[model samples]
Target: MTDIKATVFIPTYYGEDNLDELFTALSTQKVGFEYEILVIDTSSKDRTPEIIKSWEPKFKHFRYETITKPEFSHGRVRQQAAEKARGEYVVYLTQDATPAHDRWLYEIIQPLERFPQVVGVMGKQDPRTTALPLLKEEIIRTFKQFGPDFGTTLFYEDDFIDSQQLFDLVTFYSDVNSAARKSVLLGDVPYQDIPYAEDQKFGEDLIRHGYMKAYAPRANVWHTNEIKLRDYKKRMFDEIVGVRRVGKTMDPISILFVIKQVIRAVTLGSLFILKDHQYTWKRKLYWLALNPLFVIEKWKGVRAAIAVDLDDEQTIVKQSLESNEAIAHGKQ
Candidate 1:
């Protein structure tokens, strides 16, 4: 028997239904070297662990562990998973999202092996077919507003880049699909308080550590969570608040930032109306083009996420990286 050099990380929270699909997809991963599968379950009340129990018989290298205590937050759970990892590179994934490409796992780890300076690699995030139209439209809209004309999709083929540019790609620290070395994280680099800011803060920390964050276009995944304009705005607001909380709790920032971002939003949002009018109008048009169907479904999704007991499961507003359902149904 030989040891695998890489580990695939799945941070699951009541993802039994979703895990089945992702596990099936993972089976086809290109095998250059041996690999280990680490399923980090965050103590879901759902049947997710039971699902893993059944898979255990089928997979030799498959391992599963749960965080029995619900007191912890998302970042804490992620840190727990990172601690459990024993591979050269760890692949972080949302339990619901699926890898669109088989080479996704390989492409993400390749940079670290090839370049010692590359500390992390992030993949391109595309909407899966299973994603509802409202989700699809709203996601595209969010990306557009987050970084207009940056392209509808965030995949790029660059080997080396500065931290600021990497931050720009992330649209101000949203860690949707990303990977990093296990050695860099396990010991002292404590993650932020919540699940949300961990990725952004890490990329920033790596930047501070004098390492390069690489972006891989080929390594792609589909993340699903569809919301409409109102929902998108709420998500954005949550995002802004999260960042501000991190700033206040971890390290205090000057009044200059508050003043700067407010000005940027007011100015840039209006500029979006002018030079970037096409992007803004299309988003508006998508809202209008889809009519009530788009609006209702998105509103439903937003409400679904809100209505769900957060402790029980991720907001029903879940989207898949490989969502065939959304594509077929045309609803979120």
Candidate 2:
């Protein structure tokens, strides 16, 4: 079994109900070859640790470890996990997601067995049944976010700044699903400099640094969650800020670009409130009529992105706590 080495890494925090189901699905799969499981946890205040411990027997190869730094977001934390991983290949999946089929693991890892140049393979993310809207919306957001680099050139090109097809890059990447050869990721924690944007940075860096990225759609997974519209807008703003945070290290124009995007986002979101989604007579009328508030609200998300600083972790922590609680209350 040592001949074909592979490992699955699940980095988690606050994955309560979803983690249990994901592990259960993993336990039933027929992975006869030598493989290992690594779960890097950030001091979870939820039931994630207990769930992983319960599956120790079912997943005999699973190794669970925790890191307590609150400053590192999930993506950075994931890079930290990869540093400690011993497998020749690393398959990454979010706890809220589960493999869609039994052959998922096989399909994801097979590329490396056949092609030595393939440094990484990230799977397609398809929502189960009623969740297709989330997928579609995410596609739209990614298409807009990534601009022209969607599908054409293997890597983002400065020459094609307005290319619209590059949305495929986002489609190919899901924090919920991905795999990579350890050789490509070793000592690559430089991508983890922000509160988020690790996956985008990781893929971009791999391509820039001489590794090739692969998209194997057959290795699919079903994600059980979606960001609400408000949350989605906020998360994007946060990611934009994360990008700017990193960009400042490389170029200030990048930060200016983020500011431009935030301004554009405010305009785009306002238009949506006024023109898109026929939610209801009352909602449509109210939101459209009160476009100023909608614009203001979304802009707040953009500002929040600029406000986060590594040295001021507590300040960001307080805001994150408030935002999370607001979302919970809204859902309730």
Candidate 3:
């Protein structure tokens, strides 16, 4: 009879294997407030539908719907789900990300309620048991790159002195394990219709609106995608394009950037192998040998994505934010 305090929105495709654990974890969350799970499935071919149906009786406020892949737009579909959500906060999670603890739901939404200035909060991601050794090390390195206090860090618009730092923070926001105010997401700062990185685009808008984005170390999830060399390269390309689209800067691809990043990767990989006591020398050497190939693949991907002509931008990429906003305002 009462509206929920939070809505966990998940857009799932072929996620049958993880659905059971994910729902079980959600059912046992130890939050003080009431919450519901809303799943928008893109017609998964596996047993995902049956798995979801089996759990419906267990969850008091579970809801589900199926949509065709052709009808899906990452930002648009998620926005549609938010529009239908009846909660104070909208929490987004990938189907594979299981709650690290029962306290995850409570901790993830704490920052949003604690500070009016904060519009978004992202949770930490721990590697799953199946994560490769190299991938685990990569995840740890990424967290450290955020800094010593990355666990509970907050990014404010005024704190950034340079455009690059601001861009870095904007693009770093991830929807994998994040929460946002329902009012903010649906009313003032909704996600833009970007093809690849709508989370980053939404984050850019949040920062521009003078809002804060938080990193909740206490709210962590077990999530990882074991990407191979080729997939990693493709991911890098998409990321580079996403950055360019949101930044609206047509700065040409830099040869210096490629060189610098490759060198840095080599240096860091070597240092990590030399210092880490967890792995045997044979394993370290194997990773070191693969590191160069990984670096080269990523560099080539970045270069390729950047070298595309702007005249073909519209055909290759989705409609721009300006176009989306115009459509929202009935101006197109």
Candidate 4:
């Protein structure tokens, strides 16, 4: 019998800033079963290795491996982690995503333990306090669609009428705070070698192949991108391009389309800011005035990304944040 009940796996790049808190939270998990914390580092130039070493003595089963930056691909690296993991259930977490409470590990892995048909489970993500107003609302709104924050929901192939319905209702999976059965990860539905959206693709494959995926709302983590204004367009470009790479089609860019989208986004965003109680009146007014510029930048990014030739890797690399970071670090 396997002594390790679960493996909490994390992939790190320049994660020195987030690793200390994350390790502290992981070390104090309120769990009855045995588990291991395994980290795969992409040769981070920061103090990530030092931080990992500092936390080694805090856990009974903690270890990490290093891979060159150039060798990292989201799906491939994660699949490698699964192969190295010794637990019956492998839980994936990004280095920057911190568990909100001590029970996070237990809560995320429970559905996998209790439900035989549930091959995978995803936890809720709450935005960090420093998150921008738009991003904060989007995070909350996105997770709320799965179910109540305190409840659990499961999705299977039989629940939907068609592939489109399934994609629309249940294909949204995230590795930021998620768990999957070890047998399934190493079997027929292993992660594909994709540049982006691998998590959602895995979810689609699981549900299509007659397995269930679950959402445990209480398994919460803090995650968000505190994007600066100058980088917002690049961020949006990466996002839409990732969606396109996953086989989703975007509307063809046109003058009328751009005009309509910007106007609609600004109007709705302005109303949200005005109605939100989290922001002070001055902040609300600031966002309202700035909403138009953000909306315009968003549409411009979306349009440019949609027009990109999927075969042209050079052009996509220029437009996306993923490649830019690698290039900045001399990894690409």
Candidate 5:
């Protein structure tokens, strides 16, 4: 058997609709070395299993396992996948994050293959065309901070003065499109059993332990969640709460702060919408007018997240979209 160079690990729940495109893209990857696809399904009631079965014959090695929804944990399942991987590296992708090009797989694992010191590599994200203007803009802005879209940037522990400095610059590591060394994952920097921001925490852990993390901008994925207007606040709240669990916190909310945030969000969002060429003038005008409402809801969510006590499960359950989903369907 050809030795597997990497394992592409995806943890899915009700991802039947996305599997076909993801697998089709994977099949076309230009990776010169051998790799395997491993999927762990959280007992999805949809056609997820059937989809996986259909794709089994397309790859030399394909593995799938099913676990009850209640048994799924973002960090625990990923750590288990790393342990089970037959490759030197493990590349992670959420079901909806499809590779943007044939070179994605090769590029993402390139750093791990070349730089023995790089414990992890994060790929760039290009928001799907269906993503909202604000969401697309956020994705672009976030990735731009790392470096040029076609360049490679590396982060090292020796460059930062303190953990705060490290967190400020490099804590954005995302498993949505990322690769890491299996040995490091299994050894000093296993994913923690946390509900949110496990990827960021893992990156932080690796850097703190004197290891390096790389950002490969050429390795990109089309990823986004189409959040409804009504659900926007809940999503933001869930995100803030999740980051808090991973040791990142927001300042306490005040009326003055809320006012300032609202003004900032509206002004910046309006300008972004007006400047974006993707939308038509009519659509831009519409979004420009509606931007204030979304911005208001966003600040409301931020305020609620900052004010709520994390230990209060009841409050968290009420405010968090993820908590509600987990409670309702036993999946995160």
Candidate 6:
């Protein structure tokens, strides 16, 4: 076998729907480096395992293992896979997120190769066509988070205003589509034992350790899911848990700042929809009505998260906790 330059680590559960297209896209990557894929699956009852076996003949370097659901921790599982990887660079991707194009793998790993100081890099996300209007807007906003400078943008601890700002920046990155140097990821800053947002925790370690991180927009991936109010709230709770587990705290003062942001975002988005020539007034009105709901949902999420952080059990309100647990276990 050729020497592996990069390893793509994916954690999956009931991902039968996207497996075929995902493997096909991975096979088409236009790169000079030899790459391998390592998948750690939570024992799925569906045809997910069968499909993976079927694709083995097609991908010479593909390998996977099965683990029970109880054994799964977002960070720990991926870390387990990374420990087994032999590549110099480790790339993380969710099973459902397909590469936007063949160049995605090539583009994402380029930053790590170009800058020795850049320990990690993240790519842009494009929502699926089946996504709801609210989700589509969110996907656009996430893609635009890096700004116009598509080129490599480095982030350091000093760039932030305060510890909270630094924590927010570090913990906001998603591992859904990202890459890191193997040495740094395994040696100096290994993945933690967080239940969610382990990617952000890794980012925290990077900045604290004085290593740089980069945003590489040229690398694109398709990733999104339509979410109801409860789902959003549940995610917020998990996000808070992740942040606290990594020794970061959200400031009580930032609550006001977040509220201000919500108003500004709602107002600007509503005005844009109203002024756009392509949208009919009825459509404009509908969006205006829905946009505030989105803002309110986010505000609710933050508040619930704060409550979880402050509570003795480190849990959200009891009523909401039951709902979030159901959603987490696929009971809903």
The prediction achieving the highest lDDT against the true structure is 5
Candidate 6 lDDT tens digits, 52-93: 888878876988899876688888987887788889988999
Give candidate 6's whole-model lDDT: 0.75
**Between prediction 2 and prediction 4, which has the larger lDDT?**
4
Mind sharing the TM-score for model 2?
A: 0.68
Q: What is the lDDT of residue 312 in candidate 5?
A: 98
Q: 1 or 3, which is superior by TM-score?
A: 3
Between candidates 2 and 3, name the one with more favorable TM-score: 3
All models, RMSD in angstroms: 10.2, 7.1, 6.1, 2.3, 2.1, 3.9
For model 2, the local distance difference test gives 0.61
Clashing pairs in 6: none
- Write one digit per residue (lDDT tens) for candidate 2, span 179-272: 8877767754234544555676676666555556666666778774545545544654555555555442322234456555446545664455
- Candidate 1 has an lDDT of 0.58
Candidate 5: tens digits of C-alpha lDDT, residues 93-203: 999999999999999998888888999999999988656766788899899999897679998766445667556577568999999999989899999987777887898
lDDT of 4 by residue, 162-213 (tens): 6664465687889999999989999967887777878878888898788999
How does each model score on TM-score? Answer: 0.64, 0.68, 0.82, 0.91, 0.92, 0.82
Off by over 4 Å in 5: 159-166, 330-332
Off by over 4 Å in 6: 142-149, 159-163, 170-172, 252-291, 309-332
Model 3 TM-score is 0.82
Give, for candidate 1, the lowest lDDT window spanning 10 residues: 316-325
lDDT of 1 by residue, 147-262 (tens): 33322223232445456445445433334566777787774354556734567676566665666766665666777864444445345434434443354222233346545544
Against the unseen true structure, what C-alpha lDDT does each candidate score? Answer: 0.58, 0.61, 0.77, 0.85, 0.86, 0.75
